[model samples]
Target: MSPGLTADDFDFHLPPELIAQHPPARRSDSRLLDAGSPPALIDRGFRDLPGLLRAGDLVVFNDTRVIPARLWGFKAAGEAGAALGGAVEVLVERVRADNRVWAHVRASKSPKPG
Candidate 1:
């Protein structure tokens, strides 16, 4: 069996200033990195993507509107309800009909099952 991956496996250094705060003036003008052939990094525009596709290739699209879904709170110790050491960060992935949510949580420790 393969080893499990942790957040550290995907961690890398990226300067905040290098991140794009907004989309390009024209969406199609966005940058695309063509790395299909290794060791050769070709920089292309988003408009060039259609021509690079082959038959039977699958493409997934995300069109959902972005929302403010991040939440922050402290993890409480069981029964006594005392606050834990650090704050817990929750990124809500989805909300169900029952009002429960699916989220990605980050905490100093794993929260006990309630």
Candidate 2:
């Protein structure tokens, strides 16, 4: 990566089929991307995680304990859940006294105000 590399430089287009609209029925069914080795992408399922750990390993889990302020999903236009066009992801930027939130929405277009 260049020192001057901006976010745009890392931009990418993901095929709609590859986007996950919902969580897997089983948490163990999820796949994990192992990037410990650089320059290579190792795809492994959660079942193989036991092999990746050592005895007496101290583990720290992430924010799944609480509901995320962020979400990712494609716009659903019909009953079949077809990709409306690309994906929509948002992150909570801040909260207001009115109990509303300001979020950073990302997609092909900015969403209209309610």
Candidate 3:
């Protein structure tokens, strides 16, 4: 099976303020969508789950639970004589084989290898 897809293949735009910073107040209150073959639609609360599933259907979940590995820091930019202040936001996605961390970083400038 082919594995890699370019970032352009899965592009999406979301407003910054719309992103949820934390989990829902109640897990069972979360909405679930059914995107199977026929694509059935339902708008019930999470408690209505057992009545929706069948015998052999698989239910996959993210087992790699999220840890608070994201950090917000700052960096200095511009030339040494004209160092401009900048903000940086970082999220540690996973640890790599070489003991380096794969991360998603947001800043005015791109990040560089240490």
* Best lDDT among the predictions, by candidate number: 1
1 versus 2: better TM-score goes to: 1
**Rank by TM-score, descending?**
1, 3, 2
CA lDDT of 17 in candidate 3?
Answer: 87
lDDT of 3: 0.75
If both were scored by lDDT, which would come out higher, candidate 2 or candidate 3?
2
lDDT of 2: 0.78
Instruction: Note the residue pairs that clash in candidate 3.
Output: none
User: How much does candidate 2 score in TM-score?
Assistant: 0.45
Runs in model 3 lying further than 4 Å from the true structure: 1-26, 34-40, 76-85, 96-100, 104-114
lDDT of 3 at 50: 77
lDDT of each: 0.85, 0.78, 0.75
Tens digits of per-residue lDDT for model 1, 1-114? 999999997699989997889999988889998988978989899899999899998989998998689999876654565555467899999989999999999988876654
Candidate 2 per-residue lDDT over residues 31-97, each given as its tens digit: 8888767779798998888888889977787864554789897654534666464578999877799
Cα miss at 86, model 3 (Å)?
Answer: 3.4
**Could you tell me every candidate's TM-score relative to the true structure?**
0.55, 0.45, 0.48
